[model samples]
Target: MDTTPIAAGTGHAEAAAGGGVRVGALVPLSRPGWVEAGRQLLAGLELGVGDVNRGGGISGRPLELVVRDTAADPAKAAAAVEELAGTGVAAVVGEYHSVVARAAAAQADALGVPFLCSSAVLDALTDEPTEWVARIAPAQSRGWRIFADFLLGAGHRRIAVAAEPSVYWAAGARILREHLAPRGGTLVELDARALGPAALCDELVAQRATALLLLVGTPEPAVPIVTSVRHDPRLADVLIGAPAGQPEFAEWASLLGGDGAAIPFLRYLPEHLSPLGARVEAALRERLDEAASFVAFEGYDTIAVLAEALRAHHGTRTKAADFWPHVTAEGTRGTISFSRQPALTAWQWTWPPIQVADRDPANPTRFRVLHTG
Candidate 1:
């Protein structure tokens, strides 16, 4: 991670008390999956910004957005942040990957530019020496604990967890191990494999695990794992689990011929999972003619927090200090907040229960609530 400072001044005019406000997004448009995520994200932001603009445009100046594709790479992510710095964007919202967002957040903090991460899940992404990297989603560790509590409450003590080798997945695996070990339970096997077709299928069959935890965020990584597992007879009893905010599960359910076609599964939920998600769903329908995924909500919540911060700070150059307060105390995602520490608080993650007897990941056919706390 480059810790070099980025300069945010290209002499772009500051958002005046009654002047135009610009928020930029560094999204990955090349990937079909993330492109949809990004589109929903931009749509959410546009809705928020458009509402603000329509309601008299933030003290009489319209809100505007400048979007740039980061290609979802570290260097390109950094470039996107730097590019926004020169454009006088009051704040930037982007990133679905923790590692990439972590880099971009560091750049935003160095430049004193406020950044709201929409999809990054790694606790360390915002849990370090900077304040600019607040996220709308809960940390990976929090979600891990949630998943652990779910497994324990369901009387499923013997478990096997597998995730991608990415830092985010690794963090979730660690947290799950720590949380599960203390509950009179055991993680019989924990494996992190490469994200490939054969490699995933091999891991699915080779490991002596009951429940599979797919930690990779991208669908490309998750689809193969699920597809491989669906075919393997050994994994038939193993329940597939994913931390919430992954759209791949639902997409997989749909692709596998919908409900009753895939294996049973569970998902962990972040704090503040409210019915308000319907508003987001409706927005996605209008924007993309489809329902928004959990990832889409991450993006939607990100923009909500950024707009609230800008309003709270009265457009004071979009500094992190100015925005963190609003994000913590009052935000649309119901207490969206983060600190510059690597610790996971109980408020951050919760294991909500959803038992899918059918295969539809989007809307599980049959569910019995075990633990929603």
Candidate 2:
């Protein structure tokens, strides 16, 4: 695709031929980030852009993406937003890390640039609600509560969380705790950062926890903890869980093989897909050469929403976020629409489907949906 440079305040009606309506894509493709998740997200976004162009792109010009790697750093993400804003992108989209997305959202809001967050479920995405930003992913509070409910229904009253010290992980642990407290459930926090996987397993055993939730990064504390717990005879009956959807990616199975199975996690996919969703999922699977996670679907939905916003006003680039309240696009998971939700200032999808699922122990690569919300 050609790299088309857009000037700020430019309109599709005023532009000549051969110029692309550029959208900035922020993704973490490098180390220290979840590179697999980032790749899945980019695949969906790229496909969405292709579909947009094929369907008569903004005001007849092709839609282009100006890609930037955030690398899961909040400061780096903010910097990318600044650079994209200066490059005259009509809107900025895509991010996987909650911490980084929060930073990017703040910067985009301050600069008055429209941002469509593809993933990252942090409930407090911004200090205050602004019209400049919106999100496609369900919030952490909402998703985690469903996970808690799943655990309770499965008869796990004593749950333990092996958590790393990070704002995102901390927030998830808090959400789980808050949701479980009133329901006669208990949450035990084991410091994954301080305790090694072996020691973490020991704590789980000592606590008599029926289930262990992983609230840490992959390959580090999460993977090792799963290994230790699965091998320990004392933890034989203890269920392992990842409410942040860690096991949805391929890497988890590659690392733990059969051990990664049955570690239920939160996922944002409906039991059934719309017609558009099924087609996109097939395309995404071909593009990714694997089963695509919900994040990839979010990438497509993000662009779908933004495309409608841009098309609503005959391809007006200025005040792109003004299109948020009006955009209604058919997304992979469901009908995509943004509204001012309660307790949030940013435009929210109000909901996306939520599910609790895990890899099937009988077939490590296959997922078995256990619960839905």
Candidate 3:
């Protein structure tokens, strides 16, 4: 199993001569996971690792990634962290699923290993505060609140969410509910599993919801629900939304085509990229053979921050005081840094830039920024 990152530029031989700084990457690459998202995330992580090596190999030592497939399973993530800890990785990074990241974060903290979580937005990553883990993504509450605000701006005072059972979805619903209630808005929850696409549409009509938000899985219920609603005569004026970012992947457009556009979702990115962000975005497009999602940028920024922290602290792994204060790096999105937040159980980025965006109906591949926060 060659679990090495794709080396970019001309520092391979030099890097190899100085041994490698091992970082464990937990990604969901197979079935039951969002494979496309995992691939994009890995591309960014690998690109960041390559750039670090090219910039003199993390203090003259090669950086290597030990990859593990979580498959969106929390148990697998926990076990992978245990294995990675035993294998002497300086830190663990990269996970797109919030539940899986929570499991990995717990395991990493238990084993006293540092984990710079790449893209999980769950508000409470741990039950309590611990320095063993920090995150690059905004908390679910923060992002969802912004998403809820977008809905309000669009005049959706009566919103309905077809939500599946999951801590992530439940948390998002709660955030929307809380954020909306005091602002003269309301959120109505619908059981996604109990309602077929037709039933879901009927309920949307009966509830008189101005907008229908999807807090369900992609393709199965979400795609079908969108299709049903888009085709339904009674729901013609109802807006469809997916704030958890289902439409950010190419698969959504492939499956839904024109029906998938204009469905707003949350993404962590500035309207414009920094110089470093633009360069990385170009490289990522070439590397991915498609436009990269924000999750991928999170992965790349994870490595960039970790590499600088490692260099500042002599390439050591898992030291809270050492890495926490030294992680200011020029990321693809914005200057990345971490601080303790009241709402999060992990050290948060205070927030990465957040946006509410959607695919242009005329061009499914092209994203149009609808709102920024």
Local distance difference test, each candidate: 0.58, 0.87, 0.89
| lDDT, residue 313, model 2 | 66
Candidate 2: segments with Cα more than 4 A from true spot: 1-17
Query: What's the TM for model 1?
Result: 0.77
- Model 2 residue 76 CA deviation in Å: 0.9
Tens digits of per-residue lDDT, candidate 1, 227-265, equal 677667766677766554443334554554442243433
Q: What's the CA error at residue 183 for candidate 2, in Å?
A: 0.4
TM-score of each: 0.77, 0.95, 0.96
Per-residue CA lDDT of candidate 2, range 1-373, in tens? Answer: 2334322223444444557777898888987989999999998898888888778788776777778888899999999899988978788999999999999999998998888899988987899978888899988888999999999999999999988888999999888899999999999998887898888877887899999999998878788889999999999999999998999999999999999999999999999989999999999999999998999999999988888888876655666345688889888888889887777767889799999999999999999999999
* Best-to-worst ranking by TM-score: 3, 2, 1
Lowest summed lDDT window (length 10), candidate 3: 1-10
In candidate 1, how many Å is residue 164 off?
2.8
- Superposed by TM-score, candidate 2 places the C-alpha of residue 282 at a distance from the truth, in angstroms, of 1.4
Q: Cα lDDT for residue 350, model 1?
A: 23
Top lDDT hit: 3
The total of clashing pairs for model 1 equals 2
